[model samples]
Target chain A: MEEISFASQLLQYTITGITIGSIYAMVAIGFNVIYNVTEAINFAQGEFVMLGGLVMVLFRVTLNIPVVISFPLTIMVVTVVGVLLDRLVIRPIRKPSVLSMIIATIGAAFFIKGAAMFIWGKDPFDLPPFTGRNPINFLGAVILPQSLWVVGFLVAVVITLTLFFDRTILGKALRACAVNPNASSLVGINVQYMILVSFAMSAAIGAVGGIVITPISLMEYDRGAMLAVKGFAACVLGGMGSFYGAVMGGLIIGLIESLGAGLISSGYKDAFALLVLLFVLFLKPSGLFGSAEISKIRKF
Target chain B: MKLPAAREALPSGRTCGECAHCSSSSGIRFETGRDLPVKKSKNSLHLIGFGLGLLLLPWLAGHVELLGHYMDVMVFVGIYSILTISLCLLMGYAGQISLGHASFFGIGAYVSGVMTTRYGVNPWLCIPIGMGVCAIVAFVVGAPSLKLRGHYLAMATLAFCIIVTIVFNENVELTGGPDGLAFIPGLSVMGHPLDSIAKYYYLVWGFVLVTLLLSLNIIRSRIGRAMRSIHGSELAASTMGVNVSKYKIVVFVYSAALASVGGSLYAHYLNFLSPASFDLFVSIKLLIMIILGGMHSLWGAVVGAVLITFLNYEWLHYFEEAEGMIYGLIILVIMIFLPGGLVSIPGKVRSLWAK
Candidate 1:
């Protein structure tokens, strides 16, 4: 056996960090989408990711469907779940406060997770890598083929979202609704429809993240809570509603986690991200990219 | 500018002082604008009746074999009552939401459990020490987090809780890691070890009564009003000369201390401590207890705790795999249909009858 050089170790950590960070960014984006329009944190956001992974496994593994078909099928299934959540859990509230809405979402999360447990069972299920399991050697560093797939999926999401938000009329209307629902309604934009769209899109995005990461990290029913928390940490670090901020926050947390696990103790890896979250929150409540003035005005 | 003037002039609405028909000494009015249903003497009578009922519970259970089997469960109810009552004060009154209260409860359990096991410290003496530790930790955690409004504090507290649980899990040598600490000595009065379930039940209920009495006193005091004012509106509370941040921190500390006391009691009574007991799920369970019982009153806390403890420990065992689903459904049904919680049920029934 050969001794690995320090530079390669650093590169290995970087590769690992980027892979995990991409997933966190995806969850954070989902959080931001609903939060922008509703001013309520959807606590069940990570369950979409979990559903994506499990549903994909059901299609690709159990049914032996092709990856191409399974991917879209998984996303669609999760999207329906998101739509149902909006219709059933979210929409029916007569006068929703931030607290009530948050609690409702939490209940929804528990229900979804429990339902998944009943459907998928307590044991963790795995998805084979999109590509082969061969380790790719790059600049003396070893990276899994699936890590590349994970990073690629995140890139593809960002590009698609960027185009959707910038070029599409529906996207612009969604933005208008986010800016001010009352004003958007007056301008004839359907605020309720936009809210529904946000839930669908966020759920779909979360599904993709779950699909891509499943090969690397096994899919389990109860993993959503941890992912949601870490994703929330990314949101706070990146500035809650900022897209670029979510990306940066996710990557930074990933890097810290990987580097901390490698350099320090692996047992304390999760704590590193949370510590950074607390530090960011204490020093800068608005996050690095959010405006303090804007945060002060927002209800939740 | 005209709109602002109109809003300011719009009717101050029924001040408590303006309620001329009330015969109470203090000018207290219900939020629903209804007359006070119970007089001061009646309120005292209700308290006495509640105390007497509790006092008779163990004796009544001794004769009934089925009830005797659940004497331990009753003890747990008393323990959880303290935790829920404290949380009700912090969340329902002070308007500070904490998702990490289980951490304070955990801290108390761990502090007491660890100190007694490692240093051979007296089990009874460790209760205050655990509370002191929780108070300091809560102060440091609450100061910055409480400064932020809404879910930010909730998030911060949750983060702190996860961190604490992680430390409990990772620190193998000290905490005994995931296997948890065992052979924890039970508390004793004088030379008598509280070996029997009946004795422990009485002891635990004694603490619950003290906690309930203390909480009621606080709720009827000036500090409680200050807390309620903060809940209504922090800006308004501050303008009215209530030290908003100071009271928030104080209540936060107080709540943490009470949770610690519960934890300490739990540790001594069980004579075993596990990190799993202090996890995020337990924290959420505590939140559910307070929410289900009704957040607004001390008795509501006790009722919520007792019902939830029974459901979690007793009835839910029948469901097994479906337990989590049922618990989730319970939260949804209560939050959606009866947001005021189980404590509001009688009032709801009366309103329906009126209709």
Candidate 2:
């Protein structure tokens, strides 16, 4: 590795951190949405990213489908998957003990992974560049169009989800459901449908996240588990229900990981994320934007 | 057949609550209390079986090497039983979830590893110190995190578990880095270095008996009642003056301490320690064991631990590429169909037979 100047090194690290943070934020956003209404963490949420990228790879490489068709198809499949997940796993044991529900989510996570693995082997599969194979030099550091794609998609998703949650009638209903399921049910709002919607929307966002970023990081069936952990941490660190907090938490986690790895060692990068997670939980428990509702959200 | 006879006694038209079987069978058997004669007779059979196995172990060994393996497994099972029992109480009784318990296991291992490897501390002294360290860490983590109910608490512990794995994987100078500590000196008990499988087996069995008794005692005591109340519903428990949060912290810390003991035993028995063994998978395995065995029973934890450990050793290789898939599938299937786990099946059968 070439030794760069300390000033340049610090700048490089920060840029890397922000780019990674952007990806985490996107993943976290999906976590926040599902958690907000349904109280299911959607453990398979991260796999939407993996599946999107994998589908793109399989179509473009294995099946000879063009990127244009493959990407949209991938997004559609993931949405359907999200809906299916809600219908099958989340809805059935919705009345079980809290631990059972959590176990069910975990089961869903594995089931999805197993399906994905059956479809795609254990190898790390790659995708053609979303923009181009070239690197851009806008940040006084190495930045790829894919990095910009990730950041751009994160911004777009946040804005879109924020509007959907805050301004729309459906969004209001969803929020109402999250705030008080009993009152929402009493008021004739379909709590089950709201939960299903939440799951579908979260899956959609996660799939989009996968498509945009997979061009940078190669897709694998197993990538979702780690991503889910990171996403969960981001939501937790940012406060579980806060949309903006999930975004910020993702960014902060990404930054911590990137910078921590660059300054210290890459080997411990995961530990850094885990440390931040533990610290946030142990110290605040509420996280950056976490509110009482994060804890108040009932699994039972 | 044995279970059918046990079940034929329940009243034909009544559905007594879930505890009927537990009360009849275990009778809240504890470290100190009246030993129901019938329960003792049943339990004594197992005790006698264990005794015979211990006596015949050396003769059956036929070789020193296989004997060592048996010793190793026993110690692991003993330590794991301790950890599993703690988790059983916390989740099944106290109504909390932990995703990061392996971190405490690792913390215990790493503490003992560092003490013996770096500081030249005796393994015996280091064991308690490791447990103490893990207890403090658990308390620190639990104080805030435990306040959060259910899934959040699980996630918090998961975070801690990941952090510990990360630290153990990295931080070479302090933790032997990721390659893990090697050539750890054998542990000593009562001024003798525990070096043989027969001796170690006895040692581990001793701990298992102690932990099993303690856990059963707690389950039968007033503390156990509070834990059960908490499990029923935090609100109801709180309404009943259970001091829900305090009990949570207590169990969380105790579970961590138990995990520490497991970790300590694991490190000394293997004479080596690695981050991979104490990863989140291990924690999940522990959970699955407790869940599969029947969370409501103390023996459930023991059964789950032994069954999973043996199964992992014997059959996991068959599922190689899809090990995780198999594990998740089995657990899902068990939870979906069995609901209460294998232990509950007997009760369910009894109820059916009553009909």
Which candidate tops lDDT? 1
Q: Give the TM-score of chain A, superposed on the true chain A, for all candidates in the order listed.
A: 0.97, 0.93
Alpha-carbon runs more than 4 Å astray in model 1: A1-4, B1-42
Candidate 1 positional error at A80, Å: 1.0
Global lDDT of each model?
0.86, 0.75
Q: Compared with the true structure, what per-residue lDDT tens digits does model 2 show for residues B264-301?
A: 87788787888898887898888888888877677778
Poorest stretch of ten by lDDT in candidate 2 chain A: A291-300
- Candidate with top TM-score is 1
Pairs of colliding residues, candidate 2: A49-A210, A239-A290, B100-B157, B172-B177
lDDT of 2 by residue, A58-119 (tens): 77788877878887787788889889878877766624656787777777777778777877
- Per-residue accuracy of model 1 over B16-114 as CA lDDT, tens digit each: 233333624466634341111223454567679988998888888989888888888999999999999999999877778898999999899988889
